[model samples]
Target: MNLALWIAAGLLAAVALAGGITKTFVPKEKLARANGGGWTATASVGFVKTLGVLEILAAVGLILPAVLGIAPALVPVTAVCWVLLMIGAMITHLRHNEAKFIVLNLFYLALAAFVAWGRLGPEPF
Candidate 1:
């Protein structure tokens, strides 16, 4: 991988890994409070756990294929999936009027787009 691809991949890996860890282990009460704090939501733990799992899966799909040189196709697929995931996050936060998390979602969307675009063409140095 060239500098651009490597950087994009690294960013995706970092974000997904961090978010996954956060969702997987963050305390339920704390997470619920941080999750916009309303609506008597009992299933937040489930959402967080599910998000963690998907993030981990996306992380693997993002790089393992390119590294192994077996199914490079997975790289772009993973990038697109992450972009969609972030878009969903953006919409969700917007609906909830959570400005803070919405901003974070935007960052993820941009980064995911960068990864998707960067991975498409030749590896740039």
Candidate 2:
């Protein structure tokens, strides 16, 4: 279970980190174009960048605390945050009628939830 949690956390962190880097650095117009003028089309650049920064922070929070043995409780907290983020993403995608993105968001949500449950219940660190 410990290994499973670590793997899930690592995978989620990698995805969040990659997404954060892209959303943080990529221009809104290009991001919209890349997504077929989807959510980014309606969102402001500042809002999009803010989400990116949040994702980056969540990614770091997922790993660093546990690895450093400092405030390891933050691992579950970060997972909870990721779960919330995915819920928001699902809502946004639903509003836009983007079923595909919602499915992807569900996948991420499930992974985050697993990590949260594992860390909070069975695996302390």
The models' CA-based lDDT, in order, is 0.77, 0.94
**Taking the tens digit of each residue's C-alpha lDDT, what string does model 1 give over 22-118?**
7788776776677557311455677768888899888888778888887887887788999999888877777667788888878878877787777
**Candidate 2 collision pairs:** none
Q: What RMSD does each model have against the real structure?
A: 2.9, 0.6
Q: Write the per-residue lDDT of candidate 2 for residues 35-70, one digit (tens) a residue.
A: 998999999999999999999998999999999999
Clash pairs, model 1 backbone: none
lDDT at position 118, candidate 2 = 95
Q: Which candidate is the best by lDDT?
A: 2
Residue 83 lDDT in candidate 1: 91
Error of 2 at 17 (Å): 0.4
Stretches > 4 Å off in candidate 2: none
Residue-pair clashes, model 1: 0
